[model samples]
Structure formats: C-alpha cells, structure tokens
Target: MNRLTLISLQVLVAVVVLVFWHIASTTTLIGNPKTISFFFAEPLAVGKRMVQWFMEGSIWYHLGITLTEAALAFIIGSLGGVIIGFWFARKPLLAAVFDPYVKAANALPRVVLAPIFALWLGLGIWSKVALGVTLVFFIVFFNVYQGVKEVSPAVLSNARMLGMNERQLLRHVYMPSALSWMFSSLHTSVGFAVVGAVVGEYLGSAAGLGYLIHEAESVFDVTGVFAGMFVLMGFVILVDWLVTLVENRLLVWRPKTSVISNR
Candidate 1:
C-alpha cells in the first residue's frame, strides 16, 4: 500500500478503538459506567489527566529520568556487547569456556534481579540503568557473535590473500558484517531497554513514569494508570522512530527489497 493509504488505515483503526472504548466506558454497551471507570478507566478522563500533567509541566522530570536510564543502558550495553562478542568470536576456546555461563545468565529472569539491584544501587536511576543494560547486552552480544561466525570462508580467504592484516581485515570485513546483525538486534534491544527501565522503576523508584503508574495502582486511580501507560507508549514510539532513522542511514548500502503488486 502507499504511505498515505497505510497512514489512513492506522488512523482509522485508532479512531475505531477509541470510539469503542468510549462507548464501553460511558454507556452500558458492556458494563456500567462506574464499573468500567473503576477497572478500564474512561478514555476521556485518561486523556484529560495526560493533558493536565503536560500542562502543569510535571511529566518532564519523570520522562527525563526514564529516558536517561534507557539511553545509558542502550549505549553501555551495546558497546560492551560488541566488544565482548568480537573477542569471543575471535577466540573459539574462550567462547566455548564461557558458553554455559552466558546461557545461564541469559536464562535467569531479569525481574528477579530488580530487588537485588535496588539494594545494591539504591533507588536511584543507576539501578534502573543496570537492569536495562542486562536486558540489552545479551541481545546485541548473541547477534554480533552469530554475525561474525557466519562470515563466509571464501570472503575471509580472499581478504587474507590480499595481505590484509588482522586489524585491516576487521576494519574492512568483520566490522561491516557484524554491524548489520548488530543493528538488527538494536531494534529489538531498544524496547527491552525501555522495559528494563520501567520494570525497575515500578519495583522501586522515587520518580519515573513507572513510579507514577505504581502510585496510581496503589490508590486504584485507573485513569492515572492509563495516562501513565499512554505516555510511556508514546515515548517508546518516539525512541523507536529515532532508532529507525539511524538504522536507515547506517545501512544504506544494504540491498532493499520492494513489494511488487500483480494487477
């Protein structure tokens, strides 16, 4: 479909959903308004709350905190993953030695680590950053490792025949090959990074969107909870869009696939 058609469809879907939600909450289409307000919350109330928070300038501080944690986690985890992935890929013995341990760490649910991190790092933003890093690290690491391992032997042999040293080979061959995989993983890692931060904050934090949601839940303020969620969803979408731009710019040399229609 063309871009305009795609966008129109998306907007139509959103409008339909909102209308249904309003009917369900304001009218007795599904349940009483009171009951619906108690549970699902009225969309109008949620929207008003979101707007009020924005107008009062109370959201920026919480939004900034979450964004900072996510950005730090993404940067630190990705760099560490790329470096370690490259090292392990180059050293078969090292990779073999650490394989089980790496698997074990990745298998452990990150939620279980939140309280431990909170205790160690306190309720500050660093604890959330640490949690996000753990979630992002494994994603990028595995992708990079696989990318390097998947390099064609013929390509390696041809490069070596041209007298390319280890550094030159890495610069011209390995880095580029692994970068494609790294970017692919990054798209996924961005969401996980946000998840980690929000989960961490929900578990324990002085300030954050997650904290706001947790507070609303404690008081059974469903509208506030929904407002917080909508804000978070918008933030994630913005971050994902920025990541897409970076990916497109960096991977411009890669082949593009077009969808052809048969009429």
Candidate 2:
C-alpha cells in the first residue's frame, strides 16, 4: 500500500480505539461508568491531566531526569560493549575463557539488580544509569562480537594483499563492520535503556515519569498512571526516531533494496 494510505489507516485505528475506550468508560457499553472509570480511567481525563502537567512545566523536570539516565546508559554501555566485543573477537582464547561468565551475567534478571544498584549507588540518577547500562551492554556486545566474527575471510585476505596492517585492517574493515551490527541493535538497546531507567526510578526515586506512575498507582489515580505511560511511550518513540536518523546517516554506504510491483 501507499504511504499516505498506510498513515491514514494507522490514524483511523487509533481513533477507533480511542472512541471505543471513551464509550466503554463513560457509558454502560462495557460496564457501569463509575466502575469502568475507576479501573480503566476516562481517556479525556488522562489527556487533560497530561496537558495540565505539561502546561505547568512539572513534567519537564521528571522527563529530563529520565532522559539523562537513558542517555548516560546508552553512551556508556555502547562504548563498553564495542570495546570489549572487539577485544574478545580478536582473541579467541580470551573469548573462550570469559564466554561462560558473560553468558551467566547476561542471563541474570536485570530487575533484581535494581535494588542492589539502589543500595550501592543510592537513589540518584547513576543507579538508574547503571541499571540501563546492564540492559544495553549485552545487546550491543553480542551484536558487535558476531559482526566482527562474521567478517569474510576473503575480504581480510584481499585487504592483506593490499598491504593493510593490523591497525589499518581494523580501521578499514572491523570497525565499519562492527558498527553496522551495533547500529542494527541500537533500536532495541535504546528502548531497553529507557526501560531500565524507568524501572529503576519506579523501584526507588524522588522524581521521574516512573515515580509519577508509582505515586498515581498508590493513590488509585488510574488517569495519572495512564498519562505517565503515554508520556513514556511518546518519549521512547522520539528516542527511537532519533536513533533511526543516525543509523540511516551512518549506514548510508549500505545498499538499499526496493520492491517492484508486477502490476
């Protein structure tokens, strides 16, 4: 289908969902209005609360904190992943020695680490950044490791024939190849970075969108909870969009494939 039609359908789907939700919560379409409102929250009320938070400029502080945590996690985790991944990929004996420990660490549930981090780092942003880094690190690491390992022997041979040394080979071959894999995994890593920050904040923090949601939940303010969730969803989408833009710019050397319509 065409892009315009696709967008129209997407918008229509959202509209339909909102209308259904509004009817179900505001009327007896699904259940008693009061009961529905108590559980699901009125969409209009959620929207109004979100607007009020934005209008009063209260949301920006919490949003900024969350964003800061996510950014730090993304940067630190990705760099560590890339560096370690390159080292392990180049040294087979070292990779084999540490492989099991890496897997064990990666397999550990990240949520359980939140309280431990809070204990170690306190309730400050660094705790959240640490949580997010754990989530992002493994993803980028595995991707870069695989990318470097998958570099074609033929390509290496050809480069060596051109008199490329180890450093030259890394600059011209390994870095570029590993970067493609890193970028491919970044979309997922970025979301996890946000998730880690929010979850850490939710577990224990004075401020953040997750803290807002937790506070709302404590008071049974379903609308506030939903508003916080909506804000988080929007923030993740915005971050993902920015990641996509950077990915496209950096991966421009890669080829693009287009489908041809038989009709």
Candidate 3:
C-alpha cells in the first residue's frame, strides 16, 4: 500500500478500537465494566498524560538513562558476539566443545542474573547495561555462528582456488556471508537490549522509563504507567527504524524483494 493509504488504515483501525473500548468501559455490555478502569485506561486520557510528560514534565532524565543503558548494552553485546562467533566459526573443534556450554548459558533465565549484576555493578546504569548485554549477546552470537556455518562449501573452494588467505577469506567471504544474519540478530537484539535495561530498572534502580512505570504502578496511576509505556515504545520504534536504515545502506548491493503487489 502507499504510505498515505497505510497511514489512513492505521488511523481507522485505531479509531475503531478506541470507540469499542470506550463503549465496553462505559456500558455493562461486556460485564463488570468497573474493571475497565483498572485494566484499560481510555486512549484519550493516556494521550493526555503522555503529552503532560512530553511537554511539562521531567521525563527526559529517565529517557536518557534508559537509552544510555540500552545503547551501551547493544554495542558491547554485538561486539562480543561477533568476535566470539567469528572465532568459533573458524575453529570447529572449539565450537563443538563449547556448544553445550553456550546453550546452557543461553537457556538460563537472564532475569535471575539481575541481582548478581546489581551486586557486582551496583544499582546503577552498569547493572542495567549488564542485564541488557546478557539478553542481547546470545541472540547475535547464535545467528552469526549459524550464518558462518551455512556458507557454501563450493564458494569456499572457489575462494581457496583463487589463492585467498585465511584473513582474506574471513574478510571477503565469511564476514560477508554472516552480515545478513548479523543484521537480523541486531534488529531483534534492539528490543532485547531495551527489555534488559528496563527490567533491570524495574527490579532495582531509581531512574529509567521502567522505573517511572514501576512507580506509577505502585501508586495505581494507570494513566501514568501507560504514558511511560508509550514513551518507551516510541523510542523502541525509532531505534528499530534506525537499524533498518543502516541495514539498507550496508545491504544495498543485495536485491530487494517486495511481497506486496500493487494490485
């Protein structure tokens, strides 16, 4: 669909949903309408609260801290994943030996590690960053590792026949083969990074959008909670869009495939 058409559809859907929600909450048609205020605050009220935070409130400090923790975690995790993934990819023996260990680490629920991170890094940005990094690292690592492993044997032979050295092979062949997967993991990792940072804040810490939301919940301020949530969602969408832009730039040589037809 054209951009205008898509936007119009989205607006229409949103309006329909809001009307339905308002009716359900104001009437007894759905039963126990009193619970609606507890579960689903009206969109208009949520929007107004969001505007309050956006225009007159001091939400920027919290946003800044959350963004800092997420960004730091993303960078650290992606770098570590790439290096370790590349190392294991080039050394099958090591990959085999460490596969179980890696799986075990990834399988462990990361939330359980929050307290340890808080203990080591304290209830600061570092703790949140550590949590986020733990969430992001394994995702990127596995994708990169699989991407490298999936490289064509024929392509490898061709490069070798052309007298390419290990360094050249890695730079021109292995790395390129894994770039798509790496970017894919990165897109997913962005959300995980945000989750890690926010959940860490939820668990402990005085700053961050997560903390703001937590505080609001503690006070039964549903509108405030929704406002904080909307702000975080906005940031996540912005970062995801930025990642798509970077991916497009890097993968420009790759052909595009559109699933949607004009008709």
Which candidate leads the pack in lDDT? 2
What digit string (tens of lDDT, one per residue) describes model 2 on residues 32-67? 999989999989999999999999999999999999
The residue ranges of model 2 lying beyond 4 angstroms of the native Cα positions read 257-263
Instruction: By lDDT, rank the candidates, best first.
Output: 2, 1, 3
Q: Model 3 segments beyond 4 Å from truth? A: 1-3, 26-34, 258-263
TM-score of each: 0.95, 0.96, 0.91
The alpha-carbon deviation from the true structure for residue 235 of candidate 1, after best TM-score superposition, in angstroms, is 0.4
| Candidate 1 segments exceeding 4 Å error | 258-263
- As for TM-score, the candidate ahead, 1 or 2, is 2
- Overall local distance difference test of candidate 3: 0.87
- What lDDT score goes with residue 245 in model 1? 87
Displacement of residue 147 (Cα, Å) in model 2 is: 1.2
Spell out the clash pairs found in candidate 3: none
